[model samples]
Target chain A: MALTLETRDLTIRFGGHVAVNGVSCTFKPGELTAIVGPNGAGKTTYFNLISGQLRPTAGTIFFDGADITQLSAPLRTRAGLGRAFQLTNLFPNLSVEENVRLAVQAANGTHYDMLRPWMVRRDLIARADEILDRVALGNRRQVTATALSHGDQRKLEVALMIALEPKVFMFDEPTAGMSIDEVPVVLNLIAQLKQDASKIILLVEHKMDVVRSLADRIIVLHNGQLVADGKPAEVIASPIVQEAYLGVAPGRSAA
Target chain B: MMILSGDPPRSRVLSILLVVIILALAATPFLFPGAKAMNVAAQICIFAALVASYDLLLGYTGSVSFAHTMFYGIGSYAIAIALYSMGPVWAAVATGIAVGLPLAALLALAIGLFSLRVAAIFFAMVTLAVASAFQVLASQLSWLTGGEDGRSFQLPELLRPGTVLISKSLIGFELNGRVLTYYLVLIAAATMILCLLRVVNSPFGRVLQAIRENRFRAEALGFRTVFHLTYANCIAALVAAGAGMLNALWLRYAGPDTSLSFTIMLDILLMVVIGGMGTIYGAIIGASIFILAQNYLQALMGAASKAAADAGLPLLPGLLHPDRWLLWLGLLFIASVYFFPTGVVGRLRGAGSAKH
Candidate 1:
C-alpha cells in the first residue's frame, strides 16, 4: 500500500508562541511537495512535527492511516519517515564510507549483534559504497566526514538518507549551502529519487527555480497557517504568495 | 592468529608496544617471581582489562558513567562473598560469576533506562549518584558485605599458593597454585580485553560510535539511540565486572579501597584519556604505564632526590623528595597530555599513518 501522511489541526507552542499553529495537510505517495514559505513561517516546524522531533502541543499526525503523533524519532524513521537536516548533520569524525555503512547497517537491523565483526559484512559495505558512488563521493569514501567540503558534506547527508531508503524522504533544504557547481549533483539526485512511484518527497526549498523544476505540487505556508495548496504555477501566481513570499505586489504578473 | 582482534593496533609501533605489554604480563609469574612483582603484574593485567572496558563507554560511546566501579565492586564482592560463605569451592566461584554478571547487567539496564531517557549529563549524574549509593550500601551492610573491612576469603585448593601444579621447577620457579593464580588472572584479563576489542569492531560497536558522533543523525538513520546506549552500558558493565572478578581472584580479597573506591574510577578516566579514548589498545598501554609508574615512579623520584642531595644541589633534594611523587606524577600526566593530546596510542597511530 502506498504510504500516506495526514496531520489534523497540528499545532506546537514554545513559550506561548505558536511556532506551528493549527495547520493540517495530507501528503500522498508519488507527489513531491515543495513547502514554500518565508522564514519562521512554520515550514520546518511542520517538518519537525511530522518527523517526531518536537511534540505537537495540540494535534495528531497520521502515517499510513495509523496515528504516529507520539512515535519517537527513530520509530518514525523505522516506520519509513526519513529526515535530513538543513545544517548537514552527520558523523563528523567517521569516514564518509563508514558513515554510510553505519546507516546501511542500521537498516539491516544488526545493531544488537556484537559477536560478528562489521568488516565481515561485505554486503553492507558494498551497499554503502554503491550509495557513495551514486552521489559521486566514492573517491572520498575514506575521508572523514568533517574533512569534506560543505558541498560534499551536503552530499554525504543525502547519501545517508539514500542508504536508509525510507518511504518518506524529507529534505529540510537539500541545496542550502551548495555552490552553483554542487547544486546540480543534489538536485539531479533528488530528481532521480523522485522517479520512484511509491516514494513521497517533501522539500522545503527557498530557490523558486529549484522548486519549479522539481516540485510536483506546492503548498504555501504563511504565519503558521496553510495559506494556499496547489500546483507550483498557481501557488506562485496566487496573490498570497505573490505578496507575502515573492515580495511582489498582489495580481502582478511574473517579471 | 589475529592477535589484537577486530582492528590490529593499526600502527606497527603500537602493535609492538602492545605485544611487549602482553608478553610481560603473561610472563609476570616467572620473570618477576617476588610477591611484590607478582602483585603489580596482576594489577597491570586486571586494571588493563578494567580500563579497556571503561573505554568502551567513555571512548566508543561517549557515555561517562561513574558507576563502572560499582559494577566492578559487585563482581569482586560477589566472588569474595561466595567463596567465604560456600567454603572456597570451584562451583562457588562459578556461582559467583554466574550470579554477579547478570546482576551487573540488570542494574546497568535499570540505571540506563531510568537516566538515559534524559540527556547524557543526566545519565552521568544518575550513575554517579547510584554508584556512590551502592558503595555506601556495601559498606554499611556489614552482615553481608563485611562492612568497612570488606571480605577476605579462602580460594579453591587449585588456586591456593601452596597447591603445586607440578613438582618440577622450571628455571627455579615451580608451577604452583600461586603461579596458577597469576596466570589465570593474566589469561582472563587478556581474553576479556581481546573480547572487548572484538565487540568494538563489531557492527554494534559501530552503532555506539555513531551515536557518540551524532545522536540525532544516528536516530534519524533509524537507530534506537537509547536502546543501543543502554546495551552498550550493559556490555561495559559486564566487562567491568569480569575485570573485578579477576581482581578478586588474584588478590583473594575485595574491599572499598581495592575495588569500590572512587579513585579507581578516576584512574580509569586517566587511563582512557592518557592511552587514547576510542582505541582499545590504549587501555593496555594506559594501564601498564599508570600502574607501573604508580608502583615505581615514587622510588625513582626518591633516587633522584638522593642523587640531588649527594650532589648538594640547593632546593633540588627537597623539591624531588619521595613524598612529592604525586606532584611529579601530576606533572608527568600533564606533560603526556600536552605532548600526546590524543593519547599515546593515537599519537603512535597518527604518526604511522602520516608516513604513508
Candidate 2:
C-alpha cells in the first residue's frame, strides 16, 4: 500500500489532563512535516500515538486507507510506521555494527532462523555496514553502542530507523544532544531522505532553524491542540504559534 | 567455529579452562574410579547442560524464569512414571522424552506468550507461581508422580550397573554399566551444551540478546519481541528437560528434592552468576565448581576447623566448622560477585581485550 497517514481526533488523557487532545491531522507522501511545539505540548505524545506506543483515549489512525488504531507497536512498525525514540533507545552492550545488524536481520525476517550462523549472514552484514558508512559510523563498527558519543548514538539511531525502511519515517528529536558540527550530517541525511517521493517524514524538533530549512510544511501544536498547519513561513509567522510556542504571554500583544 | 555458530569463548584462559574441565569430565570413570566420583562427574555433566539452558533465558534473553526446575521435574517425573508403569525399556525413555520435551515446550509457550505481554518482572513472578504450583501438583498427584517419595524406577537392562562392559582393563576401574551411563550422560551433556552454543550464536540468539539489551528498539526494528522471547523460552525449556532426563537416568530415580527443589533453582542461579551470566562456557565452569564445592566444602572446612582448634585460633575454629560451610559459601558467592562482576568468563574476556 502507498503511504498515507491520518489521525481523526486523536485524544489521550492521563486522569484529568489531556496530553494530546483531539489532534486531527493528515500527512501526505513526498513531503516533510515538522511538528513544532513547546515543552509538554504533546508532540512526542502524538508521535507515540501514531507509532502505536500509546493507545488513544478517543481516536483512530489510518495508514493507507486502513484503520490501524488497534495495532500493537511491533505490528505498527511492520506496517511501515518506523519510529526513532527521543531518548535514543539502543542495544547498549551490542557492538555498533551488531546493533545495525539486528535491525537488518529483523527486516530480513531471518531473526528467527535458529541454526543459521549470525556472522555468516553476509547480505545482512553488507547492508549493515553500508548503513554504518552512511552514518559515518563505519570506523566505529566494532565499538559498543553505549560507548559511542552522543552525536554518534543519534546517527546510529537514524541508522537503525533506515534499516527498517519504513514508509512513514517518524523521528522524535533526531538531532537532540548532537554537537553543532554533527548537526549538518544528520540534517543532510534527512534532506537526502526527503528526495524519496513515496515516503512521509514527520520530525519533531525544537529548533526553528531546522524547521525553516527542512520542513515543507509545519504544524504548530499548543497545549495538546493543533493550532496552525501550513507552509513553514505562514505557520511560524502566525501569532498563535508565536504566543504558544515562543513562550510569549497570550494576554499581552507580540512586542 | 561453525559448530559454535562462529562464536568462540574469545579468551585463551577461558578456552583452556573449558578444555581442561571437559577433558577431566570425559575421563572421570578411568581417572577418578569410585562410585562417589562417578556420581559427582554425572552431576557436573547434567548440571552443566541444565545451567546452560537456564543461561539461555536469563543471560541471552534477559529473562528470569523460576519455572525452569518445573520443566526439569517434568522430564524426571515423566521418565520415572513411564519406566515404572510401562516397564524399564528404551521405548519408555523415548516415550518420556517425547512427552516431556513437547510438554515443557508447550508450557513454556503458554507462560511466555501469555505473560511476556506484560513485562519481564511479571513473567518472572508468573514463572515462580507456576513452578511452585507445579511442585504442589506433583506432590498431590501420587498415582502418576509418586508424590513426596517420588518415583524410583529401573534403568534399561544395558544400564543396570551390574552389567560389565569390560571384565579387566589397564585403566584401574571396571568398565561397567555405571561407567557407560556416565559416558552416556557426558555425551548427551556435551551435545546439548554444544547445541546451546549454536543456538546462542545464531541470528535467533542475536535477536534474543538484542531484546535483552533493548526490547523497545527491537520492536521498532519490526521484530515481534513476544514471538522471539517465547521461542527462546521454549528452547531453553527443552534443553532443561533434556538435562533432567539425563539426571533421572543417572540416579535411577526421580524425586521432588532431586529435581523440583527450589534449592536446585537457587543453585542454578548461583552457578550461572558464579560462572558468568551470558557465556555457555560459564555454565560448565560454574556447575563444576559449585557442585564440587557443595560436595567437598564441608569436608575441607572440617579439616580446616581441626587445624584451627589444634592451633587454639579461638573464633577461627568455630568459623571453619563443617556446619558453617553455608556461611562460607555465602561469603564466597559475595566475594565472586565483588571480584568478577561479569562472572569468570567476563573477567577473562576483559583480560584478553586489555592485552590487545
Candidate 3:
C-alpha cells in the first residue's frame, strides 16, 4: 500500500479557539484509519478539512501527490474525495433510487446533459439499483427519502457515497444516530469496503469496539493535537493515549 | 398497439388532454369569432409562455425573482423601438429579436451573478429593487422608451390587422391579419412550451430539482449550484422575452401598462401558484383560467349591476359595479388557494394517484 492522502501542519481557528491544530498525518491505500478523540478533540473537523468542507488556516493537503488544499468542495468531490455527513442530508422530495441515481450521474459527468432525458440512462439506473440493493434499500427505492426511518436515511447516505465510487472515503460518524440494532448493519457495510485494495477509508468514530474491529491503524487526538498514532493495540496501550483519551490507567481495559 | 399499451393510462390521458387544449387554442378565434375572444386567446398564449419561463426559475430552480417583467418589457420595447426607427419590414422584426434577446440575457446574467451571492430572500429583494429602478428608467427616458405613454409603431404588412392573407373567407371566417397574428402567437407559444418541457425533463433539469430540494446536498454531490442557477435564469429570461415579443406584435403597442407594469408580474406569480409551481403544464391552465376570468369578470359584474339597478336597488348596483370586479377576483383567488394549497395540477395529480 502507498500513501494516497497526506495532510501537513493542518490548522483551523474560530476566533481565538483552535479547532484543528497543526497536526500531520498520512492515509494509505488499502488501509482503514480510525480517528477517535473526545467531544472537542477535532476529529470531525479534521475530516472536514480533508474533504474541503472547511479551509485550513495553515496547512497543505496532498491527494495522490497533487495539492488539493484550496479546491472547493464540489471540485474536491470531482477529484475522487467522497464524504457522508454526520447528519442525514438528502433530497427529501426525490425517491431513494433517484437520490442514488443523482450521485451516480454526478460521478459519471452525466448530470450536465440538458437535452437527454435522465430516464434514458439505463446504465446509471442499473448502477443505482446495484448500490441500492447493496445497502438493502432496493425494496424502498420508490419511497421519498424523508419518509424513511432514521437508520434507513443513514443507509441511504452511505448509498449516495458508494454511488460516487471515489478513491477516498471520508465518513463523519456513519452510525452516529442509529439504534443499537441498526448500528451493526451500517458498520458491517462500512467494514466491507476493506475488500477494495486501492481505496483509502478515513473514518471519524467514537465507538471503541467498531474502531478496534475495523481499523487497520488508529490515530488518537487530544486537545486538537495528535496524541497517539499506531496500530490499534499499540495506540490503545500507550500510557499517554490511555491517560489523555481513555481516562484509564495503562494495562487496564478501556472498553 | 404494444407501444400504445406501454404508456400508463394516466400519461395517455394527460397527452390526450394536452392535444385537446392545443387544438382548442388554435380554433378559439373561429369558434368564438369576436375581437374580444381573439384578444383573450392571444393573451392566454403570451402569458402561458411567460409564466412557464418564470417557473424555470421559481419552481425548478427554487429562485424567486421580481424582475421577470423587466425582461418582458425589454422585449416589448426593443421590438417597438426597432419597428419605429426602422420601417415595417422583416429586417425590423429581426432587429427586435436580435436586440431584445441579448439585452435580456445580459441583464439576467448580471442580476444572477450578483444576486446569487446573497441569500434567497435577499436575492428576491435585490431583484425587486433593480426591477423598480428599471421601471423608473423606462418611465423617465422618454426619448427611448416613450415614457409612460409607450411607443406604438407600424408592424410589417403580414402582421398588420388589415392585411388579409386570402382573398376569400375560409370556413365562414375571414383569413385576415388578426387570424394570421393568432396563428403566429399559437406557434410561438406551443414551441416555447415544448422546448421548456424538454429542458425540464432532461438531466440538467433533474439537477435543478435536486438543488431545489437540498442545495447543500447537491453541492456536496459536485454540482456548481450558482452556475446552474444562473444558466437557468438566462434560459428563463430568453423565453420570457419571446413572450414579450408576441405581446408587442399582438397589441401593436408597447405601453408601460402592457409591458413593464408590476401588475403583470403579480399576475405571473398568481398564475404559477394557482396552476402549480413545478408542473410546466400548469402554466397554460393557470393562464387560460386567469385571463378568461379577468376578461369576462367585468362583463359579468356589469350585467349583474344592471339587474340590480332594474330591480330598484341603487346601493346594490353601486357595490356590484364592474369597477368592483377585483373584489370578486380576490375572493375567487382566496377560495382557489384554500382548496388547492399545492395548486390545481398538484391536486389533480394527487387525485389521480389516490384513485390508482
Measured by TM-score, the strongest candidate is: 1
Better of 1 and 2 by TM-score: 1
Error of 3 at A31 (Å): 1.1
Q: Model 1, B1-356: lDDT tens per residue? A: 34444588788999899888888888877687789998999998999899999999999989899999999998999899998899889999999999999999999999988888778999999999999999999999999999999999999999898998777554466888889888888888888988988889888899999999999888888888898889889989998999999899888999999999999999999999899989988999999999999999999989999999999999999999999999989998989989998999999999999999
Candidate 1: tens digits of C-alpha lDDT, residues A42-148: 99999999998899999899999799998999899888898888888999999999999998987887778888788889999999999999999989989999999
Give the candidate order by descending TM-score.
1, 2, 3
lDDT (Cα, tens digit) per residue for candidate 3, span B265-310: 9999999998888888778878987998899999999999999999
For each candidate, what is chain B's TM-score?
0.97, 0.97, 0.92
| CAPRI quality level assigned to candidate 2 from its DockQ score | medium
Once superposed on the true structure, which residue ranges of model 2 sit more than 4 Å away at CA?
A247-255, B169-173, B304-321
Model 1 quality (TM-score): 0.97
Residue ranges of candidate 3 with Cα displaced over 4 Å: A1-3, B1-20, B168-170, B305-319
lDDT of 2 by residue, B1-356 (tens): 68877878899999999889989999888788788988998999999999999999999999999999998998888888888888989999999999988999999999999999778999999999999999999999998888999899999888988998777665456778888889999999999999999899889899999999988878878888899999999999999999999989999899999999999999999999999998998999999999999889999999999999999898999989999999998899999989998999989999999998
DockQ of each: 0.84, 0.75, 0.61
- The runs of at least 3 residues in candidate 1 whose Cα sits more than 4 Å from the true structure, single-residue gaps closed, are B1-3, B168-171
